[model samples]
Target: MDEITGVFIQESREQLAEMEAGLLRLEQNPDDQDNINAIFRAAHTIKGGSGVIECHFIEAFTHLVENLLDSLRNGDIAATPLLATLLLECCDQMSSLIDVLAAGTPAPDAGLLARGDALTERLKQFIAAQTKQPEASSAALTVHDSSVEASGGGVVITDSWHISVRFGRNVLRGGMDPLSFIRYLASLGEILGIETVTDAMPAAAEMDPESCYMGFEIRLQTRSSKADIERVFNFVRDECDLRILPPHSNLADYIKHIQELPEDTMRLGEILVRCGALTQAEIDDGLHLQKDLTPEAGLEGEGTDQTPPTPPPPQLGEILVEHKVVHKEIIDAAIVKQAQVSDNKSKEARLVRVQADKLDQLIDLVGELVIAGASANLLAQKSRNGDLVEATSVLSRLVEDIRDSALQLRMVQIGDTFTRFNRLVRDVSKELGKDIELSISGAETELDKTVVEKIGDPLMHLVRNSLDHGIEPAALRLQRGKPATGHVSLNAFHDSGSIVIQISDDGGGLNKDKIHAKAVERGLIQPTQTLTDAEIANLIFEPGFSTVDQVSNLSGRGVGMDVVRRNIQALRGAVDVDSVEGEGATFTIRLPLTLAIIDGFLVGVDKASYVIPLDTVVECIELKNLPTDRNFLNLRGEALPFVRLRELFEVEGEPPPRENIVVVQFAGKRAGIVVDQLMGEFQTVIKPLGAMFRHLRGIGGSTILGSGEVALILDVAALVHAVSQGEEHRLLAPPARHKLSAVQNVRQ
Candidate 1:
């Protein structure tokens, strides 16, 4: 599409979306005038824009819709439920019509057109019925003619002026009707006289019924200001000749009236008579006297020194008004422009639509810039030139700033994601005949847009699961002394550089005994196994694990929760569940702020470097005299499980005399990794491993360092899980580690 067509489509789509939102609001608050006015404006804009593009069908349809809305706006039609329903259907029809236009097809469905026509006819009938009563007082003489003839000169009327209107042939076919204009004028003043001019009509056999060959000479008297009368004909002024004059008044009023007309209009004496500024006799006398004067004498009398009569200065307000640049009412509404000028001062208050692909490209460039900055810094250090070093340092800071700003562009509040669940709860609750309320908190939490998009499905699954299984029925809740309404809450916030999203429901918590029994029946766990409440609660994430006795549409397919866990892990995130017997269950997923870059600690284990995310690392300490018999460390007198990376990765190396250990904590669990060296902090740009190595455990991905060596970034959350699970198994094995140690020592 060309630029203009593209813009039209974009604007139409936006207006349609606004119309939908307004209709929904009106459904909820039918008495709200603001929402009604907003809906009207949307329709009016669509009508005007469609007219500009010459989309006659769309323009005609929207014009009828606008009329219906006008009735609502003026309170001629009360907002009955039937009217609201029909209006919503009209909005739907308009949307379908726009889609058809976008696709370069014909108009919308035939059914929609039929319904729209019926609705329009009904609305017209209602409006006509409401206006039939003679409500205006007879004494209100607002309409009067100003065409009365005078002897010396035409009597000029000011406030009480009237006009005799004459319609040319084919006016009705041109969408011009004298009655509508007359009625509009009546809204401003009373009609004194209306004489139809049929003198120009042709024979009946040559005439078309729809063609308006009649003219009107109207005499209207009014207290309305002059501008009000002009506005009544504004829309049709281009198609018809219009003139406004003052009532019978002194010469001063005539001069004032002359000054009111534009420079071109002042020369038309006939127009002045027709507009009630002068009588026809006055113009005839001027013309007759001019004919008597000799042409040569008249020309000589009008000397060059006569200087073309200077016209009166134009009204600044009127000049602004004529160009359509500003409205006179707006000036009257606000005497000062400061408020209008300052309206958009708050930059944060505006929103713009950005293509998702553009954001992705920006992030990719920032990642490359970071790697280049690192390489430059390394070269500058080796050059030993002060200028080169300073430039590189400044470049490095700029790269950091660029990376930060780029990432921030991809950060979006989770509130929108959370708000969408409201409709879900409402519909699902109604379907299941249950009373459920969704409460959300901490929705202001921000996360990477890519992660947020992927996480929505997982979050949705969790919420549906909670509502289906975790929340009890209203009767059951009441029986348990709880309120009939069940509460499901979604909360999100930042916890230590990672965004934590939690889905919780207040109902009977998971049935641990039933779950354990089911796990054993499914061979997911041993009957005699012992587990903590937290550990048992997490078993729900296992694939094909469901304790529901019978399957239904709401849930119990047993495929969702496991996928939720896997998707979170793919983002280098972790999920956990917490529950109390009868209170509720909470499922929390913690994910990194950005997937592209992170602050990492470089550690070497047997010549190979690995990166541990710096945010997860609580502290680093020397592993001097660490416990040999136990896999735990006394970290400042606290017992923390520690894993030896060298052994874990099966690296061939001799033990270093002073090994370093990095203590990392995630999801309330802490572990220490033993490494040969701690290399402080480094900016790590994440690169995903190839498909061939995607199934590899422990390593999340690899990144390039300043020295052109690839460093593997440890999946700390996965490694922690591995170590914790290993430790648990060893503890349950009844001192079998001695046999394992002998086997391990032989390998070492």
Candidate 2:
């Protein structure tokens, strides 16, 4: 697809999201006029954009939806639950059309076209019903403080919109006929009155035939909005100055409109008359009074030395106020709106749209820069020159700053991601005949865009599982002394350089007995095995594990949980569950903030080096300082399991006389990694391992050091799990030297 169509599709999808969100809000508050207007605007914007790109399949269908929304906005129809549902379905269909466009499909398939026809027929019913009802004063109009009634007697009392426009001198030379725009405007509403102003026209002999000089004052009666009227001039906006005032507009609206008008040579009184702020007689009277008050008017025949009574001439604004044609407060508000408009324009100028792929490419270049900076610092330090070392150190710091800023460019708030679940929760609850409400908290937590995109599917699965199997039915909830309505919540927060998302529900918790029996029946575990509550809860992540006896459409087939775990692990993240038997259950997922460059603590085991993510490193200590028994260490009165890299990787070398123990923590669990040397900190750029290492545990990825050697980045979560699981096994079975010593002997 071309760039224009691609951008259109992206923007259309965003509008669909807004429409869905606004419709949901309207369902909650039926009398919310602001909500209704916002929904209507979203639909109108989508339809307008689609029309601009000639996507008629979308534009034609969206026109029907817009009609229904316009009826709601006009208060011709009430906001009903069925109406809200239909509007949401329209949003879905519009999204499907956008997807088809993105896929380069020339048009929708027969099935989709038929679906659109059905939606269109249903929408017409609402519009047709609205047509049968007698028109009433719109409640939506009264909601705005600018309404005429709210201003008492100090407002323009016309039921028609007033428009003032002036075509640029070069309009005719550019081959655009000003009459064409006027004719098109007539199509939207009745032209109550129109006056052509030829004041700028020169004498016939001096006039340039091709240079146009014309303007118009028009009164239009219509139900169309100001935006709809403004769009009529979109093609010639750059070649014309236009102003519009709605029906029954207040004095403040007229004053604001006057301030926004371009500087013209026309007199102030004439400008006011053209803008419909004052009648021709009212302006003529004001101008005549001002002319009489001027000292020049008293100097008849150039011989009157009367001193003109020392009276000041009245300005146009002062004259209008003095004659009670306008208000002072309106002028003050006009000043404020002008200032706000200026500030908003300045802010808009600072925003620019960038393609995502370009941003990703920039990040990749920054990662390479970081590695090159590290290599330079290494060479400088080895030379033992103070000036070179300091220079390289400063360059390294600068490179680090750039790396951080580049990564930050990819960070986005998770709120948009969290908001999408509202529709899902709403639909799923209705489908299951349950009254479930989803509450979101801590949604402002920001993470890498890559991580956020990849995390959505896993999140969907967990949420659906909670809705389907986790939350009990309304009847069962009430019988269990719970409220008839169920609650599911999605919460996110930052923890120790990781983003932790939790999906929780207030319903019947997991039945441990059922899971245990199911696991045993599937031979996932030995019948004689005994496990703690946490371990039993986590067994759900096992492949093909489910307690459901009969398969259902939602999730009884037991296919998602294992894939969820595998996907999370692919990002070097972890997922686990916790349950309270009857209280409820919560699934917690912990993932790194970014998968690109990481601050890692470099360590050596035998002749090989490994990097531990610096965020997870608590501290480092000599192994001889603590008592080490088997595979665990006693540190400050606490037992911390230690994983020996030399034995873990089966390195063939004698043990060092003294080793360092680097204490690392993940998900609130601390472990010690035994290594030969503590190489301090290093900037690590994570490179994924090849397919051959797909099943490799303990090693997450590989990185290149300053000395051009490959250092393995440890999979901290997996290693921590291995330590915990090994400890549990040692406690449950006959243990001899904790298995590491055997590996050490074999390597030796």
Candidate 3:
């Protein structure tokens, strides 16, 4: 696809999103005229954009949608749930058409064409149902200003648009027939009157047939907007001058239109004449009166007396106001609008559109720079040169700054992703015969764009589960003393250098007994295995574990929850559920703000180095004598479980003397990692592990060190959970009870 087509697809999708959102709002508040107008504008924009790219399939389909929206805006048809749903479905069809365009399909398939035809029929039904208003006769013609003045001060009483156009002299030489444009204009509305001017024509002997000279003053009666009328002359815009004044426009409307004209500036008389607020004859008469008022015209006794100062030519604006031709308020509004437009243009000039891929490429290059800077700093420290060490230190800081700046470029707010679920919830609630509302908060929280992209599907699945399995039916909810309307909420915030997204609902919570029973039936856990309520609640993440007795379309094939867990884990994040027996369940997902790089606490396990995310590290201290039979440590007063890195990775070596415990915390749980040496802080650039080691639970990813050696970054959340689970399992074992007793004695 060409660049223009690519831009159109991206912009068209955004426009469709707005359209969908607006339609949903309109459904909720049928009298929201502003929202209805916004929806119309979005549809019109898509149609215009598609037309520019010659995407006739999209343009044709959207035109039908636009016509229906126009009717809604005109109050011919009221906004109803039925109309909103149909429009939303049309929005979906537009999206599908965009997808086809992106896929390089020449045209929509038979299925899509059929769907379009059905939707078009529905749209026509709504529009054609309105009472048809009769078109006014084209025989009687009136200029614009007279109609307004006839109704007293600056008030327009007729619904007729006045259009004025002057074709360029080179129009014919450029192979464009001026008459063809006028014929096209007539199709948009009835031309009540048209007067052609040949004043610019040279004498017959000097005239050249190819050089054309013609202008038309036309009064049109139509329901189209000024923009719609302006589009007819789009092809000839640069080669002609065009002005359109809408129906029922006051003096201010004409003034504003003159201010927005393509030319930088025009004389007041010409501005008025062009906008159909006045004719050339009226302007000529006004100018003649102004000329007579000039001081030069009032000079007495020709050349003999004292020279009187010649006052500047009476300003045309003043002259018009003096003659009661137009209002001063109109002139003031025009000035204000001109200033506002100029300011807006200046602000718009500062923005530039860059492709997403270019940003990704920049991030990758910055990641490499971070590594190179780390290597340089390492060599500088080794050389034992003070100046070089300081220079490398500054370089490292600058590289760090650059890395941050580059990463920030890809940081986008999560609100857009969250907002998309509103439609999903609305449709699913209807399908399920429930009244559900989705509320979002903390939507301004920003995260890496890459993380946001991959997180959408996982979030979608979780929300669907909440709607399908988590939120109870309205009848059931009310029976349980809950409101009839189920509420689902999406919230996000930054915690400890990571983003925490919580998806919660206010309906039936998870049933631990049902889950536990299902786990046993599925053989996910042994029947005799004792578990806490939290553990039982999380059993929903197990594969093929479903509490539903009957299969339904939305869920109960035992598919979604497990995938939600797996996808979140794949992002080096963790998801867990907490539920009370009667209240709804909440799924908490913790993910790194950015996946590319991090600040890490380096440690040595015998000779193997591992990096712990610095944000999760509480502190480090010597692993003093404790009961050798257990991996728990008494930190202050709490029993912090510890994971020995050498034993976990199976590093083949004898134990190092006087080992240190690096305390790390995740999800409100404390744990310690036993390492031989504390290598201090390092900027860890995350590199993905190979497929062979992807299943390794404790290690998240690997990073290249300053010494040109690879160090595995420890997944703190996974390690914490593993230790906690191990402690739980040990407590259940009879043999470990004696060891735990010994550890308790040592702690005392």
- On TM-score, the candidate that comes out on top is 2
TM-score of 3: 0.77
Residue-wise C-alpha lDDT for candidate 1, range 368-445, written one tens digit per residue: 888888999999999999999999999988988888898999998988688768657765886788888888899888
Q: What value does the lDDT take at residue 250 in candidate 2?
A: 54
Work out the TM-score per prediction.
0.65, 0.78, 0.77
- Residue 318 displacement in candidate 2 (angstroms): 8.3
RMSD of each: 14.0, 11.3, 10.9
lDDT of 3 by residue, 194-216 (tens): 99988888899998889878999
lDDT of 2: 0.83
Candidate number with the higher TM-score (2 or 3):
2
TM-score sort, best first: 2, 3, 1
RMSD of 1: 14.0
Q: What is the Cα-based lDDT of residue 465 in candidate 1?
A: 89
